[model samples]
Target: MTALGPEGHRKRLRERFLRSGLEGFHDHEVLELLLTFAIPRRDVKPAARALLERFQSLSAVLDATVQELTQVDGVGPHAALLLTLLPRLLERYHQDRWRTVTTLGSTRDAVRYLQGHLEAERKEIFCILALNSQNGLIAVERIQEGTVNRTAVFPRLVVEAALRHRATAVILAHNHPSGEPEPSAADRQLTRKLRRLLGDLDIAVHDHIILAGPRYYSFAERGEMD
Candidate 1:
């Protein structure tokens, strides 16, 4: 039998992954394994270590821009693109999983979905979860991409999105990149004004949710949706 080499080591890593997943794999090992797919026939250990050193964490590595990632040694455009694509791929996976949730039965359900959709966002993006007459999820539409204040999120766009989705009810949602779930004065004002504008069209604003990392603020839960 041939003695173990880099290829053998990679094979062993794959076998180990097939056996127990990433349960005990170090961060660098995970990066090494991933880089193998992008950069074949190479010892990816140094590249993995370089990535960890440059980005500081596995999450940060996955979140890095292509330009930022390519700045690291041994990370070319293909590797950088693969790393940057991971987050969006994971989001698509979650959105597929979310399709199983036909109805958001409670505020918690809506919050959970919104958190998955918006929590990792670096910039503020306003979205609306359109609900059918029976509270079933019709669609999740991104209305605006920018700061989620009154000036940034116009009523006409929100109305257009809601009407386009044919939503009887909607749950307004946005993310706070600062990781503070507390609603700003502008947030409050926008919610009130939109509630009225949407109400005029006989559309109900069920809740306004602000996702801040792992935390969230719910206007409905806080008795502010009235």
Candidate 2:
């Protein structure tokens, strides 16, 4: 038989993909298409397969750190950079969508919006839900990013940010990649510390939420904060 040659092979595959969409494609095929956008004129099938083998799944590959991604065969600094940007782009999209909620009407609404924006993260990130005199959301600021087990959030920093935003109340939130929303002893201690510190400034610490997988635990709801 005869080789179809690179150009003809790529053209045929591209045509088929355009017609069929990604429904029947393998993981490597999907990666190949993504690579085509960055490393055009190159055969990206091998690179795609390599990435899948290394990362296990497409979502894992996309979520991997740049350094980890670069370790995959055929994934150099350029490919890693492109892969890393995808999450940031998605985060921006989520942030835009979250801004549509003008007010914090209920604890559930606040948790739903925040979990959508941050639950899938591998590391812990502390975010402040700043509110106005009327309980309207003013801004969401990411204060710190820490290891999977702990996120070091300074109460003073949170208080200062609220003061700057003219916030009358604030809801503190952070993710637990382990997906257990139950507040730990340390978590309880931190909430009490923040509440005590904020009380001096007359700024209310409304709640401290632990986001774990699809579930969330609210300190205020449990009567822990009251």
Candidate 3:
């Protein structure tokens, strides 16, 4: 039997991937195969290893911004774009799947969706899911990103976003980089402020969800909502 050359080795890798999946594949191997698409006729193993070293994980490599990805040695514009876009494309697929399976109101569905949207973020991010009368998504407006303070995330701004989207209801959400879903005092205050302001406008405030790494907290589930 002839020893496999570099091209033959790459072919076998692709074939093995297509036959099965990434069930038992190493992180660098997965990344190596992925990089093959963006970079032609070059060994991607080193590039993949470098990416893992810099980002610390395959998920982080895919989630990194283009600027961050390009900082790795051998990662060019095409490779950077490819790395960042793969996770984003998967995100859109999950969102589209969530839309069919569940609306914005279901705490279960909302949690699943929000996890994908905000779980990877390293800093605080607040977004509103605007729902129509049927409880379907109308628009998802980013309220702010930073410390969750009343000043940074104004109640008026949330209501205006909902109004602009012509939404009948809204679900508030924010991430806690500390990975604890427990709402801070400012989070509680902001939720109450938005609730009252949105109430005045006759729009229902459904829930406030806090995405904290793998775990999540729902105000409605905790009976914190009035």
Candidate 4:
């Protein structure tokens, strides 16, 4: 290929991506390719490098809020939106993929499914995986958010969510944005409370999984669910 300027460089990047899908690409190159879609007709290399330098990592750049992204030089609203959209898009993709799954019989199965749904969350999100008689997944519902503190309304919400799905069993789930898989005292209390409440309704609490990034804590694994 002949040497051209910025336009040629962008074209080469596109061609290389099509040929091999980011395997040999540098972090800045990946950002440059993504920025090209939002910022046409300009040399986006500097902008990409600047974003990486500011954010300190590729994942951090994608995870950054639009306001944070727009603070960087050469990053406009359009570019910022494009960058911020990637993680949500990925989350939706993973969610859609898991929605097709019919059964979640093991802790590993449940963990894999929930990680895709909750690992990206920046705050605590309490959710339930409603399951049918044969351990087939009915639906994953978000019951509460914020901290997992006990509230008078929390049990009612859990019951309502379980009843809403007609779930014979449920797997409780919540994310710990702090990236520690250990269950807090509140988490344990809530699990015990919910298990007892759901037991009266003839519903089983299969597990309570706390997600902290890639790590997780499982109440069932520790025999706490019993």
lDDT (Cα, tens digit) per residue for candidate 4, span 1-226: 6768888988999999999999999999999999999998899999999999998888789878999999999999999999888878878887887878999979999999998898777768889999999999999998877853322228889999999999999999988777788987888888889999999999999999988878999999998877
TM-score of each: 0.80, 0.71, 0.77, 0.82
Candidate order by lDDT, decreasing, is 4, 1, 3, 2
Candidate models: Cα lDDT each: 0.87, 0.82, 0.83, 0.89
Candidate 4 local Cα displacement, residue 177, angstroms: 2.6
Please tell me which predicted candidate would have the highest lDDT against the true structure: 4
lDDT accuracy of residue 82 in candidate 3: 88
In model 4, the Cα lDDT at residue 38 comes to 91
lDDT string for model 2 (1-226, tens) is 4337555556666777889888787777777777776776777778888898888888778888889988888788888888878877876776677768888888998897787668668899888899987889998888889998888888778888888888889999999877688888888888888888888888898888888867899988898886
Show how many residue pairs clash in every candidate, following the order shown: 0, 0, 0, 0
lDDT of 4 at 126: 87
Candidate 3 residue-wise lDDT, 95-182, digit = tens: 6666664366589878888777776666688899999888988877788888633226778788889999999999999888766889
Residue-level lDDT tens digits of model 1 in 1-226: 7447678778878888999999899999999889988988888888999999998988889978999999999999999999888878877776677768999989889987876687567678899999999999999988888853322788898999999999999999988776788998989999999999999999999999988777889999999986
Candidate 1's TM-score reads 0.80
